[model samples]
Target: IKQLDSLKIDLSKTAPKKENLYFKNGVLYKKGILFAKGIEKGRVLDQFLKKINFKPKSVIFIDDKLKYLDEVEKFCKKLKIKFLGLRYGYLDKKVNNLQGFICDIQHKNLKKIFCFIQLNRNGYFQIVIYFKNNKLSMLIF
Candidate 1:
């Protein structure tokens, strides 16, 4: 909350009255504010639209979890709202250390290993593994 508080601009004269912002609160509100149990349900979009009393031409839902993105995508498709799913990426020195871990695991367990890597898509490293007859067959993610 301190970080968010720092970003607030004192636009007292320039502020628009119709514009309102609501941050996620873990408590229930009985009056004006809309609350949700979680993001994965995709109900927040509906609540927001209802609160504004407007049907937008498009909606963008950003989430780090692929499962939540998938859920929101489904809802957006049903509502004919243009949707884009974005995976949040952490590009830190820690990611470089992950390369060594990947190599160590491959050397210890797998045979005929191959990896195809590309740059800067989401700044995330994901490993997808496939197994055939309880043996590791493919790894690509």
Candidate 2:
């Protein structure tokens, strides 16, 4: 947080319009003459949307608390606004959240390797492993 101190991002005393939205009383409106001030928390939509003055069908409240979500649900019902909950609820089925994969072969310190298995003219099966250090080893499997 200290690194961001030099950015000089100052919020004015009034916070200009559309900058920090104001939802005073039951009736909604902005404070400034232009759309540059005030903010819409429900959608974070643009000025074109605010100018249209259209009632929204749904509103998704995003908060880190379950109690806040419950309160938002009640508000949505009273305003005739559909509510969408974006939460990671308890899973009904078991899920595996894996990040990486393990190789089928078992070699740990190898940076580069080549494997070749071939049958010689004398009917002998020979397997060769060429390592990164230009070292070659032959094995019979």
Displacement of the residue 111 alpha carbon in candidate 2, Å: 47
lDDT of 1 by residue, 5-98 (tens): 4886343333222355464544232233333545434667565666556666665655556777787778788888888787665544456555
| Runs of candidate 2 exceeding 4 Å displacement | 1-19, 22-54, 88-141
Question: How many clashes would you count in candidate 1?
Answer: 0
lDDT score for candidate 1 against the true structure: 0.54
Candidate 1 wrongly placed segments (more than 4 Å): 8-35, 91-141
The sequence of per-residue lDDT tens digits that candidate 2 reaches over residues 1-141 is 121246644333332334434333222434322221223333333233364565568866554336556665775676687898665444212123311221212144244447654433322233446564567644333
TM-score of predicted model 1? Answer: 0.43
Question: How many steric overlaps are in each model, in order?
Answer: 0, 7
TM-score of each: 0.43, 0.28
lDDT of the candidates, in the order given: 0.54, 0.43
By summed lDDT, the worst window of 10 consecutive residues in model 2 runs over 97-106
